[model samples]
Target: MADAASLPRPRRPVEMSGTNQSKRRTSRSWFSRPWASRPRTGGSWHAVAWIAVAACCLPLAGCKTWKKMTTSEKTLAEERTYGATADQRIDELAANAKKAKASSHADQVEFTQGLVKAMLDEHDPRVRCVILETAAEFETAAATAICKGALEDPDERVRMAGCTAWRKRGGAEAVELLAVRYRADPEIDVRLRALRELGDLGDREAVPVLATALEDSDPAVQYRAVGALKKVSGRDLGDDVNKWREWAADPDGSTAEWTIAEGFRQLF
Candidate 1:
């Protein structure tokens, strides 16, 4: 019944205002705060971030790997990678022994003895001498074996090394054996070496054998015997000096002969 002009306007839903839109945007940002924590803005930035993390942790991983390697693993790796020859291996072992820190002296002695035994058994005389030189470090039965074998070595240098080994481990039996050989050994050098070893042993029982050696055809043997007898029995062969001088001056004397004669003079 109302007039057309007076008719009521149609109602619509409430529209969002500018202030409401702003509030909605702020609320959305707050709700997604974690997503906004992106890395620096650059290409490959994500890859660099991951790499940085790995780099920081790589040393720790490497340390763990090193810890996992055992002593045996290290030894095998060295042998395989270093291409050690027989002599090289022996030298390596010797160097290792010197550097090793054993828990006890007995363990060190055992290790040294085993090393010497291995070298002496090597096919080469030079290697055997290397073992003989180190024999003083070992206090064991292996030294005894080295001495016995050295007595007959084809190489005089090797035999001399054996004499040194015997000196380091001299005993009554050891001196007696050398004394017997000093008077009877066919090689003048062997005879001289035996006398020197006996002197190092300093056994009283060796005196008689040394005295008998004075009659040997080799002046060097005779010279060594006189000095050795003097040491074992403290007796001076005063007039026998002339005999030693005559032998030493003999043109027929060899390097071994002169060396042995001189050693006697030095000892006496």
Candidate 2:
């Protein structure tokens, strides 16, 4: 048995060394192929080209296309482009508002509401006038509030603009606000404007306010109040202040008479 074990040592024959040499040659051959030997140069170039192309296209896509804008966006863009300074911008908005009013363009009017509201704090009465004008175009609650606030502006022109806008966007609340302005506004012109708007509103609640306006110190206010009274009552009393006072003395009777007169006028 000892002799047999000693003989076994000679028979292994270095098979592992030969097998390892064969595997090394196979690996070398695989790496020597043209595709395998070349670094991925083309893929790197393609990636670089893609990056360059994206950089080139970025500027073109930076802003929204004109065709992509909605009606409101387009209008805002055009209006906002008019001026660099606040005053200039406000002037442009005013011009646009006048054009919109002339054309009866509701969309343009609506588009300017935000811009107008933003300028309410401007020190220039002209700018504020433009803001009120633009705001008055919309009959929305926000527009109502904006116009109502303008009534208290220190500038008479701004207060007058507020009255004008209030007339265009009249409601029960607007009627009450206008009546207050007509009675309490320090500027006679503002009061006159408010009185005219109140009459145009034709709210029965305005009857008392109009009657009080009849006694205003300014003859012009009295005259406009008489006209407003006619508008509200649907009767041409021809500036007879005493009769207006008489009618105002009885609110219930005045309202009833106005209602009957309005019914007849509408029927005819």
Candidate 3:
């Protein structure tokens, strides 16, 4: 190390006054003297920014009151915003059905049925499903009529929706109608849906019709029918097993067929 005398001079001491005097010196601003002093807070840019942010947030905090809107007020706001949209109208109907409120002057049950019937005509499959599910809650004459008409809709989703609706509204006539679709619907998916709905209806009267589907050209339709028949009759239909096995081996058979056959095996 260098000798003390040759070492760098000690930094000149910053002789601060007493606390009050030192604070007074630091408090002197840009206009304090003939030669202006630098600002103590670097012009306070950060503080100014924080004050602006706080001012903005004070107004924004008032917006939190929107979350406390009553259900009726929320409904009114939604109606005002989305009134012209068909989707909004249908959603309103669904909400009303769940809340068991009438949406129109028509019979509450019939109004719900008509709304669901219209939804079955919608281009979106999910909308049709919602309509059917909500319609099932009505379970009145008009609700049944709408579901019956939906069975003939060109879209498989609409038809499946009808089937699900019918499942919830089970009666002798509903079972018969579903059985008819199980027998005569040209689309395999619709046929399968009808069979499933029939099984859920639990009417032994559907068993014969479903059993016929076990002979359908489409293995998926056949398997659905077998499963439905098993559920309806509560006894395994033994004669159909070999046919199911043959169907499972078919090169063109669907995975639905094999899976459904396995389900039947487990259930038995």
Model with the higher lDDT, candidate 1 or 2: 2
Against the true structure, what is each candidate's TM-score?
0.50, 0.53, 0.52
Q: Using lDDT, rank the candidates from best to worst.
A: 2, 3, 1
Q: Least accurate stretch of 10 residues (summed lDDT) in model 2?
A: 254-263
Please give the clash total of every predicted structure, in order: 0, 0, 0
* lDDT winner: 2
Judge candidate 1 against the unseen true structure and give its global Cα lDDT, from 0 to 1: 0.66
The segments of candidate 1 whose C-alpha lies over 4 angstroms from its true place after superposition are 1-90, 99-113, 239-268
What order do candidates take by TM-score, descending? Answer: 2, 3, 1
Q: Pick the candidate with the highest TM-score.
A: 2
Model 3 lDDT, residue 191, Cα: 76
Query: TM-score of the candidate numbered 1?
Result: 0.50
Residue 77 lDDT (model 1)? 71
- Report per-prediction Cα RMSD to one decimal: 14.9, 17.3, 14.4
Q: Which ten residues in a row have the lowest lDDT in candidate 3?
A: 248-257
